[model samples]
Target: MHDLEGVDRGVNPQKTSVSALALQLEELLVSSDRRGMAQVRQLWTPGYLHTAAELFVRHCQRVVIVSGFPVGETYETDGPAGAIALLQGVKDCGGQARLVGFTPYIDRLRNCVAGLPQLNQRDLLALDRSGDVCEQLQGYMAGFAPTLLIFVAVPGQAADGCYYNPRFEDISDRTLPWEKLLELADCYSIAIADSGNHLGMGRVADPLARLSIVPAVSWTDGLVIADIANWGACGLLALASAFVRKNLLRNLHLTPLLEVLSRSGIVDSVTGMATASEDGLPAFSGEAVVTTLRNAAQTLQSGF
Candidate 1:
């Protein structure tokens, strides 16, 4: 395995050639950069998409994915899309995958995942905030024995052991102890985040903090940063689809998922409304992103 311990500090650019799928996803992320700012180049290390996807495919057979960011009164739109995409991508590879999130978002998650043939009620686990979370997760890990723990747009502990939302002002007692459990469990972990406050940003906290970006307090074996957390998740699908030479992402299904999420009261993080958009971009942006992902898979299909 690659030495990922130094990833939190920042990785020096290597001479490695990145895959076409990763490059395309990176381009997509860069395109979404705020006001032409080079946050992606500045905050994210090179070759992350390829490395993370490879690590997931190589190690995570029974994957446990966690998401759901409380951006407003309810769960935001960022986490579910990535969680579902990664779940589907993992399942498409014939691997078992499950979704985990806070208890408050259980109904939303159920509604979000409803009618999805790849997922079932058994695949969803809620982090009961009122109970002993670590103990509950420990029991869960004992039974599921996940090979890898992935955090998609999920908030992480701050240096003070508290969880903060995107505003970095709202504090909450609702925290998951996945990072603490990862230390004892025999598994690898990856964090997918757009904002630095989410899990996995701890891997790149140094560079990000040098620029005054408040990064997540918890760390992981790998970190994937993007313009939006869902994009990072879709980037993984693109990578997995390319690696396995299969179009795991379908455009027809992508639109309906967002529509369902909107109808279920999942608001866009950017617009803060229950709309068919993610992080403020319209629904067509979602279609365009998935189309690019399919194109990347097609490139691999032709042996490129």
Candidate 2:
């Protein structure tokens, strides 16, 4: 309600402090200057995160969260934890939310759910990791009737029509065709990614070529890029909770859920070993990011 619209990167910071905080939040989330990701900075709309929260809170009633990127026998540790937080945020907004992924992610979500029952194991949906899932996906769409689709660290096919990990290794045989699934729903889509390897980077693929990885062929209605996928998801949660007047971060069990994820045979994208770290950053790193986001959200909501 701070009249954030039409404000040019917080032109009137004195009165539009909420917009200022939200704009600052946006800048913080996409500050990863490494890997030449800054090339797409031009495409990212100013105050778009707050705008997205408004759209989601006002329009979305049913949602499906797509995540999980497996490496070898290990799943990517980034997606599950963030997916859980997003699921909670969605439910807080009075939307029915479900998280869909491969067996590894579903397993971790289930394990984490034993301690965090708020996630509800029944909301976890699994798709075959290396098989054709067209029928399965269609059944899920028909059953859930989600109004929005969210991709968290899920990889997208490259221009060569193959899916690759950050290492540029083809993981097509191990990953799901997630882009096709979101297209099938024909609903609102948001992508949270760190690099061009993830789904929906196609929105800024050309500019991302400087990052080295071939940009994804899939595009989404909205995209949020953090140096790490989990951090971006937390940033999104902060904006959403502020708009809805709910403290969605209070119940965020990021640490415990991440502990469960570490034990779930998922390797870090950087270390290539199973640990609580994400891409080699320590586990507590996510905690710091989440805390920062929570504080920002409080500042905006308190109108300080």
Candidate 3:
């Protein structure tokens, strides 16, 4: 999947090519220049979406997707749908997938994706961020021995050892430090997020440092940034589906999914309200992304 050489099989001669489709995905997802991340976005240039998707399918076996960014009493809506989508996507690619996050949030995320079929409850793990681990999490994950670790919008530790919200407040207590797990990374792992504040986004910390957003101390082998974390997840799946010639997100009902999450009290990361908006954008924005992605990926009609 990394090579993109074989992805262009069909010839519409008019529709956007897979490479151009990747650029389109990037334009929508990583379009933010407000944080001075324009330079940061260029780090994985040319084909960040395609590169991340290719990296995912290549190392998707035994994948553990870590997500859930904590808000006041609940979690943000940006992460859940994306994380679940990634988990489902990984499984669709014939990989054994699992998801882990802090308690309460994990429970809520599990509830949101409950209607999705073939997902086992055991695959959803809740780590206690209260005290130190009640059990040996590292050892437990060692048992799983994930081939790829995909973190979608999980908060990252700053240089001061605290996780900060966009307002520059300390939220470290609510986060689970995944450093121990990230230590297992090789050349094959993927992280989907918007800003440098997310886990595994340290790769672009240098470019984003001038901005007010605190950069993460952790980095990943592959980073996929988006306008919002959910869009990042969608683009990742869309690109992967394009490459593999199978619609991984075709079953994902975006509207109902957000409605379910919103009803369950998952708030927007920016507004901190249990509304349909994701990171302050209208509900339809996500729908538009998925719709465009569906049309974009449809042209590449050959299997991996």
Model 1 agreement with the true structure over 118-180: per-residue lDDT tens digits: 667888888776777778878888999989889898877778777776566645655565576
Ten consecutive residues with minimal summed lDDT in candidate 1? 7-16
Model 3 scores what on Cα lDDT? 0.74
Candidate order by lDDT, decreasing, is 2, 3, 1
Clashing residue pairs found in predicted model 2: none
Candidate No. with top TM-score: 2
Expressed as tens digits, the lDDT of each residue in 1-304 for candidate 3 is 0112222232221366667777766765655543444557775456777788888878888888888888888888888888878888887888888888888887886675565564568878888855556345665666887888888899988888889878787888787777667664443677887777888878776667666787887877788887678878988887888666778877776767777788878988778888887777767767766666555555443432
TM-score of 3: 0.87
Single out the weakest 10-residue window by summed lDDT for candidate 2: 1-10
Which lDDT values do the candidates have, in the order given? 0.70, 0.74, 0.74
Task: List candidate 3 stretches off by more than 4 Å.
Answer: 1-17, 32-39, 42-44, 118-120, 130-135, 185-187, 301-304
In model 1, residue pairs whose N, Cα or C atoms come closer than 3 Å (at least 3 residues apart or on different chains), thus clashing, are 8-203
Q: What is the number of residue pairs that collide in model 2?
A: 0
